[model samples]
Target: MIEERNPTNTWIVDDDSIYVYGLKKLISIKGINTNLSHFINGQEGINALKKANENQQLPDIILLDINMPVMDGWEFMNEFAKLKPQLGKNITVYIVTPSLDLNDIHRAKSIPEVAEYIFKPVKISQLTEIFSQTQYQTNERIRQYGT
Candidate 1:
């Protein structure tokens, strides 16, 4: 397991239990040692995000699923747009969906809030790569901007 030098909180908003289990394992192995929050659907995830924001404990990253029982990912994004400014935090959102439809991919790409669209059954290597790039970018920003 790779060790996390700079901790980050991750939120997974997916309904599939098996996928969630596998993702949790992968995240652990990839060494995201901070807290992980799970939400069954988009609505729940949104609500939790709002609550967490109120507590000043917003997650750093969110892994969102597209299809769900109530309030799909698209709907959540709509609501999130309104709530985002109020949250007072920068949260990176990744659309982690099983859907391979072109329209879905296009829609996710169109959203400025979405960092990336990832295929289902996320790979450990992908996570590592993403984290590494994110870490590098963050360091660069800090060096340039004095954060």
Candidate 2:
């Protein structure tokens, strides 16, 4: 018998509506099973994180943008670091930005929570790989921990 898996919970924390729209389209085209959610700014993302934590429904992955109107990605990282201990689940964070600054890349790498730094216009292949790995990890955790 084949075992069915739940859709991966994913969040995009970006203020660029166009970018978000395109990313969502790509995910849709790829036919990835993800419970996707979007936040316009870092503050909104943080608020959603708090609520998700309370409900024990935290996202499995987050795509974060550096430049936003309220609370940049760095600020959100700070808040996330503080709240992370309370969240029972592991959430992989990827810094997705248009900025080509070396400092930004270095900063993202330095953050322990950040899994990778991806440039703008993410490809369908990348999304496929990410979701595949995330699903594998989630399945492993469930197998081992029965969570």
Candidate 3:
């Protein structure tokens, strides 16, 4: 789900065409966030972040897919963490994927950028959890500089 506390600007990323289509539809039909954006892969997602940063600010939260090609969530998180010192804002990230493997969960937890790891199929409750974390961090963006 995309970030939307009140009039939000957020994004969702996934490589699976059907998954993307379903998520976009589910998000919209469920009234998730009309202001939300979508991306096919981690590269596109990260590029969008760079562009957004240049324009105003990056997304407040990101629903990142773990197993995309070329640049997966693991790679995305690596690059995103590099921007933490320069962006000057803590952008909350949630790892959303269908992988239920213990290794995936353990690896995701190892990354400081990943606020949470949620397995698919995605649910409204999952979005609520991500929003909760986003709310907590958005309220203290300055305090999470090291994050």
Number of the predicted model whose TM-score against the real structure is largest: 2
Model 3 per-residue lDDT tens digits across residues 1-147: 653344345678788878767777776776754357788888998888888888775778788998888889899999988877777445678898999899999999999889888878878777666665565665455345522
TM-scores of all models? 0.85, 0.96, 0.79
Q: Over the stretch 1-147, how does candidate 2's per-residue lDDT look in tens digits?
A: 776787899999999999989988888887888988999999999999999988988999999999998899999999999998999889999999988999999999999999999998887778899999999998889888888
For all candidates, what are the clash counts? 0, 0, 0
**Per-residue lDDT for 23-111 in model 1, tens only?**
87887776755567899999999999889988878877888999999989999889888898898667889999989999999999999
Candidate that scores best on lDDT: 2
| All candidates: CA RMSD (Å) | 3.4, 1.0, 5.2
Task: Please report how far candidate 3 places residue 3 from its true position, in Å.
Answer: 18
What is the model-wide C-alpha lDDT for candidate 1?
0.83
Pairwise TM-score winner, candidates 1 and 2: 2
